[model samples]
Target: METQMGTVEDNEGNTYQTVTIGAQTWLAENLRATKFQDGSAVNTGFIPKDDDANLLTFGRLYDWHDVIDERNICPKGWRVATDNDWKLLERAIGISELEVNKEGWRGKNDIAITLKAAQPDTIFKKFNQADVNKFHFFATPAGVKLGNWYITQDMYTEFWTGSSATEKDAYARTLAYSWWNSHKGQIRRAKLQKSNMFSVRCVKI
Candidate 1:
């Protein structure tokens, strides 16, 4: 697992640090661009109140439509990570190939904690388990945007995969603490509604 670090600027002129884990290179930060590469507005989804600071920390949330649009939400030479891309990342971090493809909470050996940013008030902190951020992925608890409200800002986070699971839903990965009993600090593969909004992380093509 050779690792490399670098920087890239998106079409919005916002620059993000990038990291290479295993064979894939990824944006170390969540994407905050509000427009597509073609200069079209990405649906704002739902911006929470006092989000001026949150925008910098957590990045903007986008529905699946914005993710799959041909105009491109990620920077040049990069794309939203596909489901398989995520599996590669999981394997790089020590999850077995068998567990990476599972549909629910997966991974052993505190693998989910390895992806979360080390914040003082995060769920990992509550359990006295430090979020190592071993791969420098910097996943924040940006939460999710539902129909007219935002929920769980600092307790959980999810990312949309470019792959679709059904006409109405798409594949996603989730990180949470005690979301369901006994499922603390693990990653989940989910089929989520396309209309709901989640954080985005780009991978180099």
Candidate 2:
């Protein structure tokens, strides 16, 4: 538990937060990968091709299709997190995946909240954004709109994991202040689209 802190610079010179958890070093935020570590598009759209399908929010929520790609989307030495990797973080925090979205914060499983950055003043470019970024994760609204806005009671912070929920859908990690202060998981079943925004935190091997 002696955590070492530092920064990892991407090819674009983007310095991301880094932390040591257990024996693994992890990014304190999600991977907003706009392109492959080599500068290729990461978004999988309708036709699932180039930058046109690239995402603006949450930086493109990839499915198993893109994840399993051996080319690897993350920077050199880093790759997108798999479902199993997601599980380890939950285990270390003493939380269960099934209970992640139970509509409230559980003190026992609030580690995810601790990682979220304080809510900003604006979300999805909307005015007067909310969220205190209590955790350094600094999760922005990133606004995952399904139908008529899919925001829950406290729709301030949202996050996405590398694991897919189903064939076309994937799992998203989130938390709210309105509830009892716990972390939650959401399964997105729609196709990938740009315009949505989210934060990225990575884990190192």
Candidate 3:
């Protein structure tokens, strides 16, 4: 695909790279905004205790509540990708839309291969670089913050979806570097508690 690259600046003046994927335009980088578009701070969002340097690389991890906040976490004219929005993006990239709306572990299209970034050999032995920017998704392994100190940095990354699976649980997508498959990574949708902090990737409205 002929991907068009661009840039977007958040209300706070933090700029992010943007990429056009099929019919949609997305933030090529994970969101690192500390405030909502309305200028309200996301006080509940977790910023790793002492890891300021990694924040730029991984972006801030936010709780589901922070995502659902009416103030809006995304920049103006953009919003967090909804579950249906994710489905549309996947189908645009050729993944079947059959399981797109399913609650947990949906799809069998090797979605991870096309979305994740190429890792260094030190991180994974059989890393595949073929699809790193094939579609310009450029997903990174930013990991998650689940109450304990940041765990699995460079090993796993998850993005919060705007859809809520239940009153207390929400939908999200995850990408992981696994040793089981000879260090290959995978991506899928799953439900998570409202309190779990994960990365956010926004889509243009």
Candidate 4:
């Protein structure tokens, strides 16, 4: 597959690099918009520890309510990445057709490594400079906001898919370091609470 690159600006004038992986074009970084396209504020977002600096690197975490809002958090011509969008990315990165749609952790041949950003930190047990982050998706362990507490700042990262599994839960994708000592990484598909806060990535519509 050919990889194409470009840039986009959101409502708040925040610019993001975009990468074309397979047939879809996705934001290379997590979204950091505070307002909708029509100039409406998204009041549900929260920054970790009230640090405004984190907005540029980690982006703001938002609940599912803000994700599916009609005002649209993403820039014009783009939308929050959906469950099928994630599956397409998985298949493009080497996951088999059979495993791409399965729930729980489903990836093969270091797929997680290919999707994560190559950070020089101890959060990952193993690091491969050559094969990691081949697509420039730049997945980071931005952690998440649960209720009033922020946890897992550098351990793992989860992105909310625009697909809903139920009224109270929605689908999401997770990338994390394996518990055992190894270079291999893991990706998971799970349904989480709609109130839980997670990062968002936009896909070109």
- The Cα local distance difference test for each model comes to 0.83, 0.46, 0.77, 0.85
- Give the candidates in order of lDDT, highest first: 4, 1, 3, 2
Candidate 4's displacement at residue 31, Å, is 0.6
Tens-place lDDT per residue, model 4, 19-117, is 999999999998888898899899777876569987777888999999989889999999999999998899888888888888888876667888888
Candidate 4, poorest ten consecutive residues by summed lDDT: 177-186
Off by over 4 Å in 2: 44-69, 96-111, 119-141, 145-156, 178-199
For model 2, residues 113-173, the per-residue Cα lDDT tens digits are 4444443223232212222222234443443433333333235444445665556555545
Model 4: lDDT of residue 116: 82
What's the candidate order when arranged by decreasing TM-score?
4, 1, 3, 2
Worst 10 residues of 3 by lDDT: 178-187
Error (Å) of candidate 3 at residue 19 is 0.8
Residue 164 miss distance in model 4 (angstroms): 0.6
Please report the TM-score between candidate 2 and the true structure. Answer: 0.58
lDDT of 2: 0.46
Task: After the best TM-score superposition of candidate 3, give how far the Cα of residue 138 lies from its true spot, in angstroms.
Answer: 2.0
Model 4 ranges off by over 4 Å: 119-127, 178-184
Who wins the lDDT comparison?
4
Residue clash pairs of candidate 1? none
